[model samples]
Target: MSQGDERGYGDNDPGGRSDDAYSTLGGTRQTRTRMPRGTDDGEGYGRRPARNSRSLVMIVGVVVLLIAAIAFANQGGGDASGDAGEKKPDAAGAGPTAATGTKPVEGKNGTIASGFAHDQQGAQSAAANYAVALGSAEMFDKAKRDAILSATHDPAVVATLQTDMEKAYSAGFLKAVGLNEDGSTPTGLTFVSRTIPVGTKVTAEGVDSATVEVWCTGVVGMAGDGSTKPVTATWFTITEKLKWSGGDWKIESSSQAQGPTPVTGDNRASTADEIAGAVEGYGGFTYAR
Candidate 1:
């Protein structure tokens, strides 16, 4: 559309061939009159000639039915395979990008997703979820961190994790990150710490154990107009050695390292309030492979 003439109708129409222009159809040059709406075919009030009304209705009906039939055919024509005659992939899933059709675990241990299936796919899902819980801002709070560890970790490792995390989130560390000693944000600033899993891979699996790697991206720091600790995104991968304990996959041990990060894009970053609002408003999902 050209500027100031976007609507090509009425007053804003970009003028094309005028009505008096000679026609080129059938190798003839006959001048024709273009009648205004409601006056075509000598009929008034936006109507066509009564004699041709049946033909017009039939034409329109045929067009509509043809369109409908074509749409119906197209709806069932999606086959992500080599040829129309080839057998399609399984309904559950196929290929790297396909949805597995596997339902996520329905249980939650405290606020974290739990009770994953005893399979490779289930281990991947658990690793992703455990990464989110472990990277959350709640880990800076003593009680909530304990709850999170107990929910996500193996029974033998919860106490050890609790002790390590307590030292990791010391009062001095909280002050350095512009958070209060209790993990709460100061008067007006919002503390943001959230991890989102980008992808998960099951490296090894056994009858009752698995090792899954979750590639994650996260934002952490204070979000306020002029806060010193503006939120920043970090990329990392967490390798979790999981055990199928008590009908669910639990984190026996986990370690994180620098990422398989991608090159940065040129998109403009959002402001503090926008980031904070997004962090608070967005709800996470229960993932399944």
Candidate 2:
């Protein structure tokens, strides 16, 4: 007999001979046979299980990779957060800059004042403004110079700095910047010796003292009519040793060095008239941390 007819019936075995053959092997006489529920011989049954397992594995792997990527992104791509993130104000004895709620006082001396926290920012601001005040044209004037010295310097250093500054701003130095021997304002020209602090930093801090470095750029020239070199800007760094005195930080000792400067710009220089007007119109800032 043919395999289909032998396994099931005489002629009309339409359910397929495979089902009949499976039933016959098990000694079943029934025309209909029950297939094994989880056999590998069915269409796509064997491959589909493995495929599903692989698909699940891939999905799990992708999820793990996404989690790892997000973690990496939060760490700023592994770059370190430096002094910027670490800065914090002092707890007790906080200064005006630290509180910000406290009003700022008119600086004790010239434009350079100090009521900053005894922390990094305060130390830096004090150093920078002190450098500006010390390097200013006002330091060449006798009365204003004395006032600045008295206000910002230690009592012991004031006298010494006064004498040293007098010699430093001598006749030859005045002549170089087109100023009179007594550091008077020249006719039709404004003497410029303004130091603008670029940034401030504290190298070291102690209970009674601190070491600060001030990065600064300054203009020192005679501006206006008949000026040879109208106004020239130069970059410098000032290192200050400061002491906490009666209610303020004062300069005990200080020194200066030139640049970290860059090459000159190609921009056209402003006319002496424009420069003078700009200088007069603009007011200086009361710098704080």
For model 2, state the Cα shift of residue 70 in Å: 56
In order, the Cα lDDT scores of the candidates are 0.53, 0.48
Q: What lDDT tens digits, residue by residue, belong to model 2 across residues 223-249?
A: 788866445555555556677787678
108 Cα displacement, candidate 1 (Å): 1.0
Among all candidates shown, the one with the greatest lDDT: 1
Candidate 1 pairs with clashing backbones: 38-46
Q: Which lDDT tens digits does candidate 1 get at residues 157-268?
A: 6675566456545676566556777767898888776666677765555677776666665665566787665555545555666778878888765444455455655455
State TM-scores per candidate: 0.66, 0.61
> Candidate 1 lDDT (Cα, whole model)?
0.53
lDDT of 1 at 48: 13
Error (Å) of candidate 1 at residue 242 is 0.4
Q: How many residue pairs clash in each candidate?
A: 1, 0
